[model samples]
Target chain A: MSASLPSTSPFPFPRFYNFPPFFSRQPTLQTHHSQLRKWSTLILNYCRHHRIFKLSLIDALDTELLYNKSLDKRMGIGEVREVVEFMRKEGRAEWAGEGGKGVGGNEVWIWWRNPEEWASLFYEWVDDTAQKHTVLTLYELTESEATISQEFHGMDPDLLQKALSILVKRGKAQVFGQEDQQGVKFF
Target chain B: MSRKGVGLAAFDRSRITSAQYASHGNSLRSSHSTSVATQLSVFRSLLQQFAQTHAKDIRSNPSFRAEFARMCAAIGVDPLASSSGAGGKDGGGSFWAQMLGGSVNDFYFELAVRVVEVCGASREENGGLIGVKEVKDRIMSTRMEGSSEITDDDILRAVNTLKPLGSSYSTLTVGPKIYIRSVPKELNIDQSAVLEAAQVLGYVTVSMLMINLKWPRARAKTAIDDLVSESMLWVDMQCAEWEYWSPGFMLGTGDDG
Candidate 1:
């Protein structure tokens, strides 16, 4: 089932998206590799366009990202898994589970921007706003009206923490408080 | 009696007249060659002047460039012929490199490089075979707006310019369409036939091939299998009958997507 996205403009799919055979897994090794590459790019772009942080493969199977409704062709679940596995190797995706052991998991974190990139964005925003020394609760940083216009606004809390941990390790920020109510102070 | 003693004198007169005729012929031959050389020099200067004036058009205008190349061909001048060995008049480089200051030659060379890049990028997908139009589209799409347009003719000429390097790039005709094949692979008659049939609807089934080409089921299957192995065709198994598709169709039929 496709996500009921905002009534914004639909994604402009690449020309190959309309090619019927793109839905099927190519038998040739080279062709299949190329197909996977295209799929990976398309998936990343689609998620970014929709502001999708994590993807459920089964849910996306019927979406335009993996299905060509006009041609009545859809990528099979195994093929989708293969493409996700390819993206995992490229470091653009990760299976959504603890300890990176989500083998055969149906959920994936499509890293349109990796956690490090998200960390830099957060640091830049804090620096630009001159809020360097001010303590900001994790909830305030992601859900505050002040960050409404920011790209990281309403980000998933776990992913935001992962990003914040990078800044913490770098000594650019300090995190203190309970796990559910942590606060951050950037320097 | 006095006239009868003139036989030796007559022979001497005949010899003198023959000597005069030989000298006159020599002078005439020398003058004719000089005049021909002058005409040739005049023509060369005129061509040079024309090329100098229209250098920009030759580089930017596709038809104008084609016509200019045709004129050179008509005059038995190879504009792209490198001047290194046979014709040492220019010392080194091609005729175009010498006359129009290499703009025209550079244009083709640049286009050839783009062609090679496009072919290399898509080699894994199409198995090193791509439609000439597809190559042009790929190149043009990456170009900025208001850039000069490229035609299929220019693409073909660009491929020809790659011959000196002994590249595997060459053009082949399959069913009414011309393709630039960058690999050294050869397709048998049956594979070509299947490919040609696939052009009709972007795909071909064994039954379709069997019915249309009067091929037995085994023969059609073998041809399709051969193409799939070459990566030239992708098989769609979701259909009622497995459909073999031409990868070239990926570029042709998806504009609305």
Candidate 2:
């Protein structure tokens, strides 16, 4: 069990991470539930620590997040996809779209911070930046030097749109854009 | 416990000395230590003769060996410990422990370890549980140096010795049969009662649980499903009746209708 993974891993892998059977889906109900729960937590924590906003099944395997090359053990793609789906059900992640990176299109958008939490953070940033009642492109909100120190900088565009939509629903911001040019004006 | 076990030394000596001489004399009371010494020699020879003559029977028959063990216990002699060159005075029984296959306790202890190993090898399927009879069969099949008269009693005795090691090994009773568990998972009362009903042919179904335990459909399913998930019982979904058999168990005690 002492066989360790790459020291570069974002999160401290659990002790059972070295157990060979750790990757195999446990057939028993209680054991299976516990395994899924632990895997889901590990996935969330890993992505959050590495500022990882998107994770497809293929990239996850190569990153040594779902597979341990040292132990020659890996969670099958299907098993990993199931864990992502479980995270989605728990509101910790969301499907990227009707598409995926790998064959099955099982790519998922990992949401380290749920939309509500991100929206509140964005609203705070806008308030502190004197951007209230001023129009700003989606790019300026996430990419500009004004928001460089923000934890949510370089956010996924889809997630940025969702965060703005939350402020829009409360009449705190308004979104207006053409087909390729999008911008939001906070009120 | 060892106190009571050693109590037989004085009692057995007095009886043997009293039986040989019918004379009522104060000398017998005065020479108590010498009388005990003479009686011990007589008793040792008698036990030695018994072991030499019954050596074959004890080796071939498990029940007879168990009886012999009981008698040894009655006289405060351990069939296993007396042979390890440990017991200083009761030395004649060392041959008995040897004749019965090199310390009965050692044989059984070895078997107990194997039983747990096999049961735990496939934890996902077996839940570290194997039938007690299956344990006996596996031990008998193994070609050990001595003591081929392996029986369920020996298995039970060896398992009892493993109890102090922790909950890793234990004997579970289901109806008239026993199952050995090499893990510490707890079995709730309802789950136990469900297994108890399964002793008839080594299996149970939801319908069987419903009828035997007089349970509602949901109640029966919950208990059976718990057992299945725990791997304490196996499910045969292909069967029309949905049989849940605990493999490597099921010694029919004729209680089944």
Candidate 3:
């Protein structure tokens, strides 16, 4: 007895979005399983489109992430953590503190792209730009107008380092930093 | 004459098969005809013999008890329906009471009472709602180590019989889920309708209730919260759309938990 609902959702919510139980956590095992899957997919897609890296649970609670305005329902912090944790297990998200499982961080990093994928993209860009054997400051690679069109442009430096290191291991890039400046050079 | 083997004064084959129904003038058919009473007596004697011979098996095996009970029923005997016949001054009802426990009916009554006691609550307390499957599991588990198995029909029958106790104990339907309400809690039509919508998946959230019931946020929350406050439900505050679960419907309502 699912409910019938139609709305102008920013994201493609599943048909079950109208089903009341979809909003509530299911008590029965079989139903709850599908519910978890739906929540995980929602989190992944929402994060990818919104480019959400560090998502604060408290803020999400007020946003459509936790409370669907059209539906007028509120998801408790417990369920948010649960779905996000599910994403974490799938390598789609993680606790905002980088990797610690510390209690109640109330935030997560939605990693739609794995470090390996990012590294490959970075390597491909280096080749296309014909920048082999040229040195560029880490800041230039991130904030430079020339890289603005790239998907990883303005990326988190820590994540950038992770990607760049992958290239380094492949003999395609090297990172060097003086007391004043950090630079990465492509081979 | 030695009254051996049921000690019948005579083995009257003509009496059974209703020989009386045969044309009295035609004695040829009389030998083949038998009466219903005679057939029933023969069945009764044989049943008593079986019960006496396999007392231990009948008492230890649920299927065996069910079969025996079925046989007794076919003979128009209820081993546990009443305490007025068969088993002497103790008024032990039928042979069933003497053979089994008090009676099969008593077993079901005990099951019904225990179910209500464990899950029942007033409207203020969460409206004594329970999952039908869970009740069945609990009843089965609670049976004596070796007793007849109870079926869904038995549970339903027991609950139906509870009407004399009042509306406080009754079975109900909300969509596909069957719930036993054991209290005077007033679940409104809106709530009932909302529950009906969610019964397929065994849960409902405030947002879902709001949409399904066409109620305002405040109204939806009030209804769901009312249910939560009453141990009638367990809140699954794990997702963005937090849900409520009837404890009986929950997955891991277990010992490690």
Candidate 4:
């Protein structure tokens, strides 16, 4: 089963990933906290490496991120939730649903870069290209040929909207049109 | 009595002989001390020259450095000894620091700082008791490629250099492995035994301890619990019988998965 993982340049797992005890929640308070810290770092690095912006706890269970097929050790859903909750407290993760507690949520936003960071990137790109006064549709900003080399390119539209909303709030950019087809004009 | 002369003349002659003897002994003693001082100065200069010439090798080569340290120890010269107490005459710093232009002492001092960092950072994970090899690996891993290689011996020396600071950092030997214990905590006999058993398989269950050490179940459980509370052991509940793992195992299994 371990052999079936895509061998094309896999994400380098930390040494402790093979440690069986890492899958089990430590009973000791300090050890558990340390375990959580390692898990948090691994999750962030893994998502950033794969360019994964959102994670579904259920789907991730079957993946190598949560399961080590070689060791036959897998983190249970509750354990994974606890890790996500830990990340949430650190502001590195958030539940996908609005006004929904993360306790029952299956999906989460892994904020490798928080909205403010993404907004700044968008602002910098606009400023660099002298497109400050030009109007760009949400699709054009993320999917356009000009932005193909951007880190924020091919970003999730919902996340893109959230980032643009920050710019709008700062009066750095203005947003208009329908929710599905929004046009942004940066100042 | 006639050959020796009268009493007053005999007394004067005896006094002159005694004065002559005292002068001759003072001259001999002064010459002996002068030669000894000359030999010591020659030895000091030769040692200084050797250190100056091989300073680079001393810093870059771990074995050469260790051999040099051992040679100093054999001669009753402490290379890492702080000169603070004797600095009034020779300025401040260590003996080696002055002789080698501070490179050798600085090298160990810098390495000691790194060792302290690794211990402090992993204290929460391993309860401030970390394997010497693990500490070396941690330090080497963080170093840049092509940098000087650090050995376990070097780490031991670095820890030794921490003695003057009165820090709790000390080396310990448990079950054939030397560990750097950063917290001033002591392990009981049973706890150490369980730790030794865990070294074999990277972990040990209460049943394993009970059967191997002829320990009762309660005795085994207490030792494991003590280690767990100290954060020295992490308990894995996924197995049928919970296995207590030594955090040292985290760095040992690099080939798996």
The numbered model that scores best in TM-score is 1
Can you give the DockQ of every candidate in the order shown? 0.58, 0.04, 0.03, 0.46
Chain B TM, every candidate: 0.80, 0.62, 0.53, 0.82
- Model 4's DockQ? 0.46
What is the alpha-carbon interface RMSD for each candidate? 1.6, 15.1, 13.0, 2.5
Better of 2 and 3 by lDDT: 2
For each candidate in turn, the TM-score is 0.87, 0.42, 0.41, 0.87
Ten residues in sequence with the least summed lDDT for candidate 1 chain B: B82-91
lDDT of 1 by residue, B31-121 (tens): 9999988987898889889999999999899999889988988987767664323564666755557788889888988999999999999
- lDDT per residue (tens digit) for residues A43-157 in model 2: 8777776667777777778677887777566788888877877887798877776533333465677777888898999888788878888888888888887776676777878
Poorest stretch of ten by lDDT in candidate 2 chain B? B248-257
Candidate 1 local Cα displacement, residue A17, angstroms:
0.6
Q: All models: lDDT?
A: 0.88, 0.69, 0.65, 0.88
Give the winner by DockQ: 1
Tens-digit lDDT string for candidate 4 (B105-127): 77888999999999999998999
Clashes of 1: 0
Q: Rank the candidates by DockQ, best first.
A: 1, 4, 2, 3
Total backbone collisions for each predicted model: 0, 0, 18, 0
